[model samples]
Target: MSEGFGAKVPADVERPDRVLAGLTARQVAILAATAATVYGQWWVIGRVVPLIVFAVLAGPLVVAGIALAVGRRDGVAVFDLARAALAFRMRARRLHTRPPGTGPAAPGWARERAHYSRYPCGRTGQLRLPPHAITDTPHHPAPLACLDLGTSGVAVIAAASTVNFSMRTDTEQYALIGCFARLLHAQTGPVQILIRTHQIDLRPALAELADSLGRLPHPTLRAAATAHHRWLSELATDTTLLTHQVLLVLREPTHLHTTQPGFTGAVGSGRRVAAVTRLAQRLDDARRTLAGAEITLTPLSPEQAHAVLATCADPTRDPTHGWTHSWEHTP
Candidate 1:
């Protein structure tokens, strides 16, 4: 960055510029709107009430306006925080997963008394889901682990290997950073790096050890292996082992290479072909670029990508490791 933008460049380029009296445009607007609202309120209610009473009513409004204008929580404006809070409060808390046109309803006998301040769905036990989690219904030409996020775009995900940055020397670190920078600069479309951490699973390792127990050549070797396995089991019981996965997400808009705008929206065969080609090319470029920094990229199969999304949507319902879905072939 120093080579391109000189020694220093402002990091918070997205931060709104202060327009008047140390207030951003949003803050200024909010304050002005509040002032207008308070003046209108006084025009209607001030004459009916005493001076002290009117001040009492307007004091909270003034304080709220000032707080909205100047206050920030965790670097987010107070007004935004309040809006988000309102949205959160309004959204359904319990969500049910079921096929379409299967939402349960109150019985005919209890229909009159059923509709009130909600408790719980007596039959199905949750409200309808917000939207379809994945629409594999849409024809996708790419056989890779990519999703057709209709209208939004197509996204391809690759699991990325990590490098031991702390172990590298200063010279190696600088070179690695350069490689990383090159990868970032080379991106023509959106590239997202997602890091997810989960509890390490040791069941498969233990099962493998058990299977190998009888195949050992000597009793001494078998006994040693048994002891090591036992020790590992004990260690696992005592410690919480953690593992993290790094995923590189590459996106290609449907309309990028397609001529007809409606074709992109429909995600026709040609549009799908274009999206797939672009995504594959980008993924290949990223793999080669990241390899310079000692990072390997492994493209995920469609099943694995879907599993990852399902896990993300409802983490508590399934374990992250060794995810298996009904869509996968039994074999």
Candidate 2:
């Protein structure tokens, strides 16, 4: 792991068998170095206590007391504060969870005798000690695959693809229709097709406009309402109105570009802001490409959308048919 957020995600969660099998050579070296340092410190403190006392016999005992308290209490407090800070920053971030039902080992696992064993050489009387390997030879079983082990058991989300029936050539469409019919006829799985219709709400805008008119003189308000109604009536009858059908293709992970324009240059900076900016630019480019193909692209903002659609029934402009309309709404 290359520092930064790498420490947040444990490579092996309590599954010591995986820890043994999966650790890199460098990681093993670091683990050994850390263990050696801790044990070496303990050994020095144990055997050299008398010598240290003799060397610092006149040294103030007060400083030693403060050092001990800081090492034990303040050091622990600092460690805990660092942990809390990391946790707070991580809560909103999306993390890949480990396979279900894995947790860290119990306390003092490395200190346990089961974690290490001494071996005797066959050729000589020399003794060699090794860290106990977490193997499935006799003690452990195959770890469980990561799955959602909720009360509802494991669940997986899959999205079904949508089909366009109106765009293809007649011959190709007919062939596809026949193939789909045959497939549906022969299929055995329980399949469901859902169709959802979203309707635009213009009541809020209408009410706002009405309230503005209500604050005017009674006669003026009445006249303005009549004019508005007449204008909408004329537009419905005299203008060609076509439904601007928008098909949003959310490219998802499949169509997204893996490399950004400046990502290579900024990779080492590790700024999430840069990655997000790249994604935004890519999304804008994708939408522009779609719009160039005559697809009406809508934004994800509902308020902005409402403001844009507020003029849907306006007299001078018709958004349907991309400024060219052949069929007008009849009321």
Candidate 3:
């Protein structure tokens, strides 16, 4: 008996003792508690139930206990799992119901009829209304009316050319700064300056260059022109050129009285025209002020103003595709 016990087992041999193993200690306790609860219910009832009836009553509890105890190895205790499941179920139920006072105001009968029309199964139907249908409320503001010089009452936009600030001497830069200061100091209303930098598209420039190359008279020069055009084509693909635009926004005086009260009791067209004229004069003054500092300012046309707004609204869009000219300079 001692020799048989001491003998070593081969590595490939199966271990018969490990087969038919029972549940872990925690799983056994959970299953015992579930069984006791079920048995207690049956005893209280004082009846012998069918197997199917017993399974229907107690199957879920047994499955839940076993799953909580042994299904996962993520180190979460059984009670935490049960709490998480309860919370998840509560959230699902809340999401299925409509919040109070969100949908259209209607009588209970109308709402019930509409619901039955959409879902004929009454309360048992699984059809669900989209959240947007219940929650969406749209309110659109009135479109802005433009006055002379494309001026809106809130702001005036002016296109300005950029000077090489980095290359200017100290004295020149100081003069430029002084000029800007005076420009702002002259404004009785608010002033806002917006600077936009965008990638320049070179397709038109390339086309123009190609057209110029076709007109070269001398053979050697024509050959050289062809080579240069090829180089430009390659360069266009390899590099991106960028341009800057400056916008000068001047505010209109909101306190100015109208000649006649309009339907909205706001500023009348005559008053708006007068206000725009004043704003345009101020912009011209600014233009002259910047001109002394070697910067040029041009007023944007209605179409140009729309393009500028579109580019500003979405910076990633191609700035030059729609507009005939670049925003950085006048055509």
Ranking by TM-score: 1, 3, 2
User: How should the candidates be ordered by lDDT, best one leading?
Assistant: 1, 3, 2
For candidate 3, give the lDDT of residue 114: 74
Q: What lDDT score is found at residue 317 in candidate 3?
A: 78
TM-score of 1: 0.68
Cα deviation in Å at residue 97, candidate 3?
Answer: 30
**Candidate 1, residues 1-331: lDDT per residue as tens digits?**
1334334657666788989998899899999999998999899999999989989999999999999988988888798899999877777664555444565764876865565627753443343321112222224334456565545566778899989887887778788889999999999888899999766668779989989999999999999999989988987889977778999888777554433222224536576667767878888888899888889998877566766765666555454343333222211
Candidate 3: regions farther than 4 A off: 1-154, 165-170, 253-267, 320-331
Tens digit per residue, CA lDDT, model 2, 1-331: 1123222556446423334447534345445655565456556674657766634642444344333323335434333455587877655332222322343544686436534647421121212111111111111122111111111121111122345656776665565556545534643222233332333434455556566665666997678786785665566567654433232222112122223322123432244233233434433444454343333333333222222232333434432323112111111
lDDT of 3 by residue, 77-155 (tens): 5656787988765543322123345445779997688777854432321223211100111121212222222222434
Candidate 3's displacement at residue 246, Å, is: 2.3
The worst-scoring run of ten residues by lDDT in candidate 2 lies at 129-138
- List where candidate 1 sits over 4 angstroms from the true fold: 1-13, 42-53, 99-143, 199-241, 253-273, 313-331
TM-score of each: 0.68, 0.22, 0.46
Better of 2 and 3 by lDDT: 3
Give the lDDT of residue 151 in candidate 3: 25
Give residue 142's error in model 3 in angstroms: 29
In the order shown, the candidates' Cα RMSDs to the true structure are 6.6, 27.3, 23.7
**RMSD (Cα, Å) of candidate 3?**
23.7
